[model samples]
Target: MNKLKVAVIGCGAISRLRHIPEYAANPNVEIVAFCDPNIERAKQYAETYKGRAYSDYETMLKQEHPDAVSVCTPNSLHARTAIAVAEAGAHVLVEKPIASTEAEALAMIDAARAKGVYLMVAQNQRMMPEHVRAKELVDSGRLGKVLTFRTSFGYSGPENWSVEGNGTWFYSKDKAIMGVTADLGVHKADLIRWLLNDEVSEVASFVGTIHKGGTDLDDNAICILRMKGGAMGSLAASWTYYGEADNSTVLYCENGVMKVGTHPEDQIILEMRDGTVERYRADDIATNAGQQSSGIIDAFIDSILTQTPPPIPGEEGLRSLKVVLAAFESQTSGKIVRMT
Candidate 1:
């Protein structure tokens, strides 16, 4: 079997921590190229991973002609990079908030479709073990219909997670575009949409910059979502979480309530209307403090190799992104934004 030639753009923290390592672990993948604006960083990764490094992605794409590429660039660059990769006839696994705008995302999807290649968004939360089990429980009808939910994702800030630390592009409005809202909020938006298998029909939000000083982007956001199925929920994303990162969700259903990622030992907790309680232990949820395989790379590789659509395809990503975008609109307008 010919190993799938893969390349990574933007040798940032995400590339170093998740994309490169995950690809290296896949027996079916061969790292062929690495690209970053900082050529030295790219060269370092190339030296360690046995790939050629380039400062320009276009040059790398032209020369290497990889089978697939991971677009780990800043949020604003995702669309342009992914569209170029698709046009180059390579599959794309782009980092989340797939594009800065819905129009950009649609263009990327169209490019991939026209080129007969796959375009996947890296929404890793859906692949987390605990979330997977929670999905199963929800689908099993054991928890009945989810009527309400509260999902939150919070951490110290991107300064702690990014390779550039305090100077990371995450703190730049032009580069990041949306701070915690896009960085962390999109994950829960995707997760909730996927977990309930429902669309968010309406959104109202309060997004603001609370603690962070360097950037004008929001450091905290609280959004209220109304699903098409009549289920309602609140989603919070924050960079103001002082101590440990919190990625937890609770679902109130007709028959019971389900809690996920709230406890250290038991990742999922269930309370029944019949006065019964259940606990489940799954693999720990991946966080900056305790990193784990996201399963995104493997799934992206499998989709390319099998000639199937990716699990989190461009459309699904766009759907989740719409929720985030709506929240932004609601925050600015002080009114509920309804999705059409």
Candidate 2:
């Protein structure tokens, strides 16, 4: 097996918890470089991960020329950073929301296409065991066509989980773009599209910033999705859950209702209209700050090794981002926004 040299830009919490550890665990990967604007943070991560540390990603890329790099940066930097990594002849796996804007996401995808380098979005929910099972059920005609669905993903906020412990860039408008909508909502958007195997046709939303402090951007959003194939769904994202995070989804189909991530133990439960009950079990979804293996790193490394396209490519990320962006647009226009 040819090992791919891997570098990580932005040695923040996500890098610490997910990217570095997962790559380190993969036998097909070599941890090469760690970069962060904060020199101390970079050095500390490098010390622990056995990678060279640098404050500048460009310098690291120029010297190492790693075969694969993960961009765990702020939403605003994803496009430019991933584009640069691709242009430098390396495959990139970017943290999600893809970018702050649709155009930027498209540019990143175009650059990768032009360079013949693989680009994947870190939409890890698709890798959740129960969700994967749900897809199988959907495709098996067990669900008999989903008619409606609802999903929610929420947590306290990013203040405590960040590498800085607080004052993370997530609160800033310039860096975060739209707070919880980008942070938590995008994941659900991707998950829904993957489960239904359809794009959203239109979206209407009411976005708010009710509970978070030190932020001007929205921290909560409720969006209604009309799927291209005649399914109706709703999604809610919030940083004001107050209690433990709520990360759950339920799909209503012709034959039954699919409940996922709802209970503590039952990862997947099916309830048929004929008063039949079925339960499917799998591992829980990984939290961004958790140490559990995301299954993304191994999957991503496998893609680069076999010269196969990533499981969640840049275009797929763009689709999810467009839904979130359209929600923001809907809030401003006070009308359902058509996803063009």
Candidate 3:
């Protein structure tokens, strides 16, 4: 079997911890190229992963002609990089929030379609063990219909985790656009949409830069979402938790409440109205302090090899991104924004 030639764009923290390592672990993948604005950083990863390094992605694409590319660039660069990779006739696995805007995301999708290449969004939360089990329980009708819910993702800040430390692009509006809302909020938004198998029809949100001093982008966000299935939920994303990160979700179903990532021993918990309780232990959710395989690389490679749709296709990413974009509109206008 000819191993798939894979390249990574942006040798950032995510690429270092997740994309590169995962791609290296896949027996069917051969790391062929790496690109980053910081040539030194790209060179370091290239040395470790046995790939050629380039400061410009276009040069790497032209020379390497990889079978697939992972776009790990900042939020603002996702659309353009992914579109270019697709136009180069390579599959794309772009980091989450897909693109800065809906128009950019649609353009990327169109590019991939025109090239007949796979375009996947790296929404890793959907692949988390606990969330996957939660989806199964919900689909089995074991939890009944989810009526109300709350999901939160919070940590100290990107300064602590990003490779650039306090001076990361996450703090820049031109580079990151929205702070925690896009960095963390999009994960919960995408997770909830997948878990409930529903579309967010309306959004109302409040976002502000409370802790981060240097940026105008928000560091905290609280969004209220109404699903097309009539499920209501609140999503909280913060960069001021002060302590350990909190990634938890609760679903209030007709029969009981389902809790995920709330307990150390039990990753998922179910409490019934009639006094029944169940506990489940699954793989721990990945955090900055302790990283784990996201299963995204394998899925992306599998989708391409099998000639099937990616697990999180570009359209699904667009829907999830629309929710985040609506939340931003709601915050700015001080009015509920209905999803169109």
Candidate 4:
């Protein structure tokens, strides 16, 4: 079997922690090039992976000609980089929230389609064994009717994501465009949508920075989602949670409730109304669990080799982004925003 040649476009923390390591471990992938605006970082990554290095993507695209590229840039730069790589005839695995806006996401989609290359959003949570199992339980009618759900994702802000610390690009309204709602909110939105197998048609939300000093972006947020099946759900995301606890999701059904998060060996917990509880732990879950970037890389390879659709397409990512955006809009308007 021929290994798929791939490039790591942004040699940042995400690339180092997720993409590079995951691809290195995978037998079917070859690290062909590393590109980063920071030349030193690119060189470092190339050295680490035994790949060529370039500070400019065009040079890398022309020289290495990889089969795929991972766009691990900031939220604002996702669309442009994705389109450029796809135009270079390499499939794109873009980091999520897809893009800052629907228009940008659609443009990327159009570019990828026109170039006859695949464009997939790296929505890794969907690949978590716990999440997959939960969705399976819901879809298999084992959970019966899902009445309501409360899901949340969060972490302390990245250590050096920006120069401003808490007031970095993540907090900058101009660069980030959205805050924790964009960072962590999108994950919960995607998870609930996948679990319910429906889109959020309407949303009402409240988002603000109650903590995370100097950060202009919201440190905390709560949103109510109305799914197409009349299932009412709530999503809460935050960057203010201190210590080790990070991401968590809970789904309440007519029969039972399911829970999963950062727990080791007992990530999935099911509680029933009958005072009985069951716990499930799957070894198939990725080491990073929900870091999402690695899953996206693996899925991109599958899409390229097998010609199968990615677990998370750009459109699906766009939908999740739309939900997060609608939540922000609703927070501003103080009314339910239809996700049209």
- Every candidate's lDDT: 0.95, 0.90, 0.94, 0.81
Candidate 2 residue-wise lDDT, 1-340, digit = tens = 6678999999888988889989988888899899999989889978887879999999999999999999999988999999999999999999988998989999999999999999999998898788889899999997798999999999888886786656789988888777899999999999999999999999999998897777788989999999999999899999888787888999999999999988888889999999999998888766654547777888899998888999999999999999999999999999999987
Q: Give per-residue CA lDDT, model 3, range 1-340, as digits (tens).
A: 9999999999999999999999999999999999999999999998898989999999999999999999999999999999999999999999998999999999999999999999999999999999999999999997788999999999999999999999999998899987899889999999999999899999999989887898898999999999999999899999999987999999999999999999987999999999999999999988998899999999999999999999999999999898889988998899999988
Clash pairs, candidate 2, are: none
**Model 4 residue 8 lDDT?**
87
The ten-residue window of minimal lDDT in model 2 covers: 284-293
Candidate 3 at 61: error in angstroms?
0.7
Q: Name the TM-score of candidate 1.
A: 0.99
Poorly placed runs, candidate 3 (over 4 Å): none
Please provide, for model 4 over 202-223, each residue's C-alpha lDDT reduced to its tens digit, 9 standing for 90 to 100.
Answer: 9999998896776567889999
Per-residue error at 165 for model 2, in Å?
2.6
Question: Candidate 4 — worst ten consecutive residues by lDDT sum?
Answer: 284-293
> Against the true structure, what is each candidate's TM-score?
0.99, 0.98, 0.99, 0.92
- Of the candidates numbered 1 and 4, which has the greater lDDT value? 1
TM-score of 3: 0.99
Give candidate 2 regions above 4 Å deviation.
288-290
- lDDT for model 3, on a 0 to 1 scale? 0.94
